[model samples]
Target: MHQGDPRDGAVTGLQAGDAVDLGRGTALLGCGGGGQVDHMVHALRVALGADTVPVVPLDGPAHSVIAVGLVGSTTVLEEKTPSGRELPDALAAVERWTGRRADAVVAAQIGGVTGPAAALTAHAAGLPLVDADLVGRATPRIDQLSLFVDPLPTVTAAAVTSSGLRIVVDAPDPRDLETVWREAVSHSGGWAAFAIGPVDAELLAGRAVDGSVTRAVRTGRAAGRARDVEHLAAVSGGRLVARGRVLDVQRGGDAVSFVHGSMAIRDAGTGAVVRVEAGSEWVHCLVDGEPVASTPSCIVVVDARSLRPVSTDRARVGDELAVVVLPGAPWWWAEPHRTDRVAPRAFGIDADPVPEPGQRPARGGVR
Candidate 1:
């Protein structure tokens, strides 16, 4: 095992305490989408015996890496808990499809419970958890995964629900895989555990978003020293966009996507109107009718007083909130192919992507 820095440097293991910090960081990174971070942390400890889970750096020895996560109603995932075998089964399905065995597991996203949950999947499969992830933040679409960002020779999507329902989709197009898996999830008790890839180290090297796992842990640890939200923002490479009360909440008009809606916040100091447009996750933000932030750039909203991150589905009128903008993974915007797909317009919101403010944290939180 490699040993260098406990938080960053060539780390080799993720202690249970690091998992707790990771949950806290994912809550902040989730931006108002991924929820139940605390719950996943507990589930990880309970199912895996609260022990250290080995961590593998992206540049570590060559191994096949598979990304794992849950999809569908996180609400239902909460009520009827998963049995922890779902993802491992999905992993098996992927292996069957690819005729290859996986040596490690990666989280689909580090934004919510998926980070910890994927870590659990790694433990259950007796594989080291890769220190990388698919999407660097919370995103609703499966097509947006880093693995899907590029064309793979034998990429497959395998899913299994806690109720024993299972599905596997192998297609040339990522959209086809997304649609089929989503349809299966709709009938499989609302949530399904999924595994993507059998990606070899060479291909994974060019595709995966590196260092996201360590970034989440570092961000979470930094939050421990944060005196307030402002201090947290200063350290976490985020900027305050709005500090006010929720004035109104807008719901679906014609497009009934998974929770497509908008929230308006009235700035307490300048009285400027801040509009947050979202579907599945907070995707766009506007101030006085000018686009300030858009999809792929996290729009994190939190309680103005306690600074605890708020969930998008839970936002309502009369809530005092402070909104922050965190830089998303740069991989999405690094190429035309990836940018066009992740842009707001791709999600049906008519707006160009707001130019990224600057450098995003490189898997180490803030700079």
Candidate 2:
């Protein structure tokens, strides 16, 4: 498996316990994308005072296990952060509409700000935070969830805005509900809270990404050693990629897009040049015109100074970033299954996996 962050450096000092505490807080702040560490960190300072935080797993009773996500324009949410109380109200409204008591609250998406947001929502709702999530990485569409895998029946849902506007949509197909809620949220210039998928408690186990809090802690520790503001990424299994400065940005918008853009990377020390294209996730990575990483993998971008992950919605030009590629769960990379599902090619690019001259293909036929 590929290490999560691969940069040139001596490994820094990191402890497992620290990772556990920071990770627990990070998960809660994941707004709608995975928990954004920035928000999680802030929330932690305000909400958590005691030392020695316990990382909570997403495994809990499956009966009435509801999946919740913030749906709306991320841009709007950024300008107007949650009030901390709105999320629980939304959850309660959904419960009232459905008459179902939630056993656990699971994140629907676990990237960007959403990761931490979900965790915070769980904490606020006083529910157990499940380690599992619908999408391990950020996805553009709401219907792209494993909870819909078995063709489940109609579950209840409530889409609430912070401004006290609430809309409840219930149907067999959660996708339809997602579409409706997205449009509503977009129009209102607000975000919606979603709770759906009446999942069987046992199925939620072993399905979500576990140990991410610990992983983040470890990654942060490794990155804390760097003295300058450079590109630093958290690899899945603790590998380093390239560390550099953002020379140019080809795209930027405010529609809550899964990140999509390309940039030129200049090595901080040697001043070497590397051109790379990034999408909703760091789906493809090239060093000096060589492909080193791609999708079905975890690519995290963090502020060189804060050592925290950045959300696609907030990534900006000249933001010094570390591009790290970590191995995703083995299930996604199995055989030829995920070949085009989440890669750059799947999103309509003709470039093949460009391995860094001497490096072999991590999987499949890159040779």
Candidate 3:
């Protein structure tokens, strides 16, 4: 493990092997969004080389923690690679805009690429990474973050393209910020590196999902030992709700903001069928046309053979998969408005978000 400053003392850094675990953990948490981490893992490995990337506790003495990740359609990102400098450039831009140096960097969400992207940015900037995140998983919009619901001050944001172009926005309204950032991403050839927030440790302590980074690492390690859904469930709050081979996939309307679609997975033995809806992230899932799991609760599809997650873009016909459902972060359950913001209805599904089996009822009864 790479060590940070002696004054910082004993901080655990992510070794090269941890990248694989982090990637798997993030894919599980992505809820079928957050883009794939295959490229990110390669990037991080090359960037960190023989040294471990330092990770600090969120509660550590950092006065300012900036959230950093890629913004825009994951489909576009696959074709347009980042310049390897976009994140650091955006981080520098955020620092200039905020007039405050980033004391640490935190993942915007614990999804496939974003977590590693944040870690890479922190390493590039020579700052410690916080073992926490704004959202426990990926969401389609900027307004979905717990920090947004907390209405944290808009400390300015920077979006940098792979071409080295940069645009900074200072919108106070989260919704407006999303709109502007999306437009900027569209203009930048559909994706860009985004740096937002200077959320203080004090504010993050109260609002950010604590220990999420560590959870991702743990979940990744568990995945390596997973023999079945039961093993996966033991580590993540995930359960195998359905198993089948994909029969068909129908994409929803094309949007610059997200990749939307629906897919049907049919059981080979029983011929039972389940349909999964996606909006950047998987939003709702149904077994035999009856709601089984919906947004606010994570619905994921994993390869039955390898137990590796299958992103919506990659779910093909004849691929055997286990549909798994996991409980959302505590903040989503605690905040009614937050749940409503990402509810099935928000994704054009008519049903309400459903809780995982044996899980406590969502507060306010699932909007």
Better of 2 and 3 by lDDT: 3
What does the lDDT read for residue 109 in candidate 3?
91
How many clashes (backbone atoms < 3 Å, residues ≥3 apart in a chain or on different chains) does model 1 have?
0
lDDT values for all models? 0.79, 0.55, 0.79
Please, what is the TM-score per model?
A: 0.91, 0.73, 0.91
Span of ten consecutive residues with least summed lDDT in model 2:
8-17
Error of 2 at 32 (Å): 14
* TM-score of candidate 2 on Cα atoms, chains taken together: 0.73
- Measured by TM-score, the strongest candidate is 1
**How many clashing residue pairs, candidate 2?**
52
Candidate 2, residue 17: lDDT: 30
lDDT, candidate 1, at 168 = 83
Off by over 4 Å in 1: 1-11, 47-50, 253-257, 359-367
Tens-digit lDDT string for candidate 1 (1-367): 2234656474467766677777888888777776678778887767655567788888887478888988887778778887768888999999998888999888989898898888888888889988888888887778777777777665578889767887888778887877887787787788888888887887787777788878888777777777776887887888888899999998774243367788999999899999998876788999999988886787888888887788877889999988888887888777766776667876678777786676442332211
Model 3, range 109-150, lDDT digits (tens) per residue?
A: 987789888878888999988888878888878877777876
Q: Show model 3 residue runs off by greater than 4 Å.
A: 1-11, 254-257, 268-271, 361-367
Ranked candidates (TM-score, high to low): 1, 3, 2
